[model samples]
Each structure stands twice: as structure tokens, then as C-alpha cells.
Target chain A: MAKNYTKISIETSNDLKPKDETIDFLLNYSKALSVLKSAKVEFELVLN
Target chain B: MQEELITDATLVSSYIKGNESALEILIKRHKQKIYSFIYSKVYDKDVAEDIFQDTFIKVIRTLKKGNYNEEGKFLPWVMRISHNLVIDFFRKNNRLPKFDNSGEFSIFSVLSDTSLNAENSIIKEQVEYDVRRLVDELPEDQKEVLLMRIYNDMSFKEISDKTGVSINTALGRMRYALINLRKIIDKHNIVLTN
Candidate 1:
């Protein structure tokens, strides 16, 4: 096995969850999710 | 995550049980955000609206019969539709619809005739333009994930599922996307309040 030497940066997982910003362009994305749920068309999953 | 699951499951289940009104409530609940998400990708109001209506229409058909299993993330599922509709829109015209290079979801929604009375308070117009420019500079993959995750407010897991990649890959893409955006902003000497 060839040994390689290089400095590597590593990260440990933490409880830092991303905060949802209200001002980002997607401020209204929740409502989009809602609209998809009540969409007006129906289809068969084409289950094969 | 728990809250989204609960709400998604509730709305989907209600629609499944022969309640048409439930679907209306669902549409009313999501119109702005979904419209915003679709418009972000398509960038034209008429085209976006058509694709949006088509997405929901497909959803309706998906639900009318005993098709949906009700065991999936509803938002992601619908997003899959929006994404597919976007592709169809492109393919139908024999051209791929690439998103605007700027990551900013167009601010046009905020600038309509009624903009003076809206309640959102955050970034100003200049910052929005800067953010959009930075987003536009991203590689397509990173840009797609960022749009889905940030603009669509999808979870990493959801983004991964929708994009057909592993969760770690999705996370990596988003991490790199932010890093690139920072570089772009600094390179351009743009300051965003975000």
C-alpha cells in the first residue's frame, strides 16, 4: 500500500441545524408544498 | 421533520378519503410557496403558472384512484412532479430549461401591484440581486440542490431522494454550494444580510 501524507480537514457532527430564513426568496415555499398536496389531477402509478 | 410528516400525512390522507374540499384546502395552503418554487426555476409567470397547474393536475390524477401509497414524503413527491414538469416543459420545446444563474427566486412576486402592503421584512432589492447573482454562479448540481433545499425548503433527505443521490452526497453538494456562494460574493464584493 502506498502511503500518502497530506493535511486533511475533518468535521465532527454537531447539533447545528440550519435556521430557516423568512426573507430568502423561498419565503413562500411552504405554501407551494401545500399546493402540490391538493393538486387537481390524478394518475395511476404505472405500477409494473 | 416530524411536523412536516404529520401535516403531509394528514393532508394526503384527508384527500384520499373522498374529500374534494380537503384538496382545495391543500392547494390554498401551498399556492404561493409552490408557485414561488416553480417560478424560481422557470422564471416566466405564464409558463410557471402552466407548469404549476400541470403539476397539481398530475397530483390530482395520482390521487384519484388507489395509486398513492401514502407512505412517502408528500412535499418531495410533489417536488418530483414539479421537477418532471419542468423537464417536460423543456423537452417539449427541444431545449433544456436551465435555471437562472442567480439563485435569487425572482423578486417579481414582491413587486406586483400589491407589494406596498405585504408583511415580509428582510433583504432589500439590492441584496436580492446580489444573492441571485451568487446563486447563478454555482455549478448546476450545487445550484439545483441549493434551490430545492433553500428555496423549496426541502430537507436534505428530501433533496437526496428527489435528486436520486445519497443523503451524504446531497449534504456535500449543499455545503460546497454555500462555500462557492461565499467565494462568489467575496469575489464580486457583494454583501448580503443572509
Candidate 2:
């Protein structure tokens, strides 16, 4: 029996930034969506 | 029942038995993280909200059908559902962001390219693993601010208020987090692509 393996090559870049508009968008969207989801669940439960 | 003390599996079982409050408790417990994971990919409030709702609805439907298997790991299951929904949202919209040669930043570009060759898939997986490991290795304060900002979708002001720090301090922590992550990637020679 032989085991299969995957080979990975690393190419590093210095351009990726931590803080960006995308990050902001994701964070804010998550916060708002989470609140909405919880409310929706509660509402659905009430109707059931 | 003390909802706080109840395990996720127990809450899920209760919900399956028509205990609505159990479902509510489950939602409240994992909502923030699940929502954040979805928004990280979709990055739209309304769409993320829609998908978030749909994810839970699907969860309820599946649970009712006795389909969900990861009883104790409910949050991870929900997160996976939200992630697939986000992908479906992109596919339906036909607006999957691609890597631009001009280098405009979009989180989608970092995810993966449309090409699905085995080699490229392996490389993408490795890159993702490396990046995740680097993030996990970040200092606690830096990682906290980073996750709150990126995963939890919090503003610097909100983070500052929540953590009892000045907004500047919160911003600085995020900045340092990025810089440190960049340094780690450079040191480890990890390559990221779309």
C-alpha cells in the first residue's frame, strides 16, 4: 500500500493588508445580520 | 431549564421536541460567530442577513427531518451552512469577485480562483491553512481586535467601547495585527493567491 501526498509551494508577498474596507464591510455586515437572524428566529418561534 | 447550562446537543434535542425557547437559546449562543463567518464572505448586510436567516431555517428544516448529525458541534455545522449559502449567493448573483491585476482589494479574491485543477486546489488549500495558522498564532490582544473587526464585524469605536479602550488603541491593535501577520507570512514564505 502506498500513501498519497500533496506538495505545496510557498510564494510570499508583502502586499496583503490587515485592515481594509472589505474587513470593515464583513464586520459590520456580520453584526447587523446576527441581530436580524436572532430576531427572525424569535419571531418565527412566536408564530409557531 | 437553565439555558446557559444546557449543552448545544441538549438544546438541539429540545428544539426538535417543539421547545421553541431551546431554538432561541441555540440561536443566541452562536448567532454572532455564524453571522460573522457569513458576512466575511458576502460582505453585504442585507444579503448576509437573508442568508443567515435561511441558514437557520434550513437547520430547523433539516433537524425536523432528522438529518443533522453533528449534535454537539452545532455552531460549526451552522457556520458551514452559512458558508455554502454565501457561495451560492455569489454563484446566483454571477458577481464572484476575481483577482484584478490592478490590485484592488476584495476579500473574495483571497478565497480562490474559478479554476479547479487539482494542483491549484492543493495550493489554495495550503495557502488557506498557512494563513489560518498565522492568524491563530497572532498575539491575544491583536488577534482579539482582528477577529472582532473581521469576523465579528465590529467597528473600532465599537471594539473600543466593548473592550474599555480608546478608539485609537483599538485601531492601533488592528494595525499591529496586520503588520504582525504580514511579517509572519513573509517569514514563513507563505503565498496567497486568488
lDDT of each: 0.66, 0.71
Q: What TM-score is obtained for chain B in each of the predicted models?
A: 0.45, 0.49
Error of 1 at B152 (Å): 62
Model 1 DockQ class: incorrect
Q: Which stretches of candidate 2 lie over 4 Å from their true place?
A: A1-48, B70-72, B99-194
Question: Using Cα atoms with residue i matched to residue i, what is each candidate's TM-score against the true structure?
Answer: 0.38, 0.41
> How does candidate 1 fare on TM-score?
0.38
**Candidate 1 RMSD to the correct structure:** 29.8
Off-target runs (Cα >4 Å) in candidate 1 are A1-48, B1-6, B97-194
Report per-candidate TM-score of chain A alone: 0.20, 0.40
Which predicted model would earn the best TM-score? 2
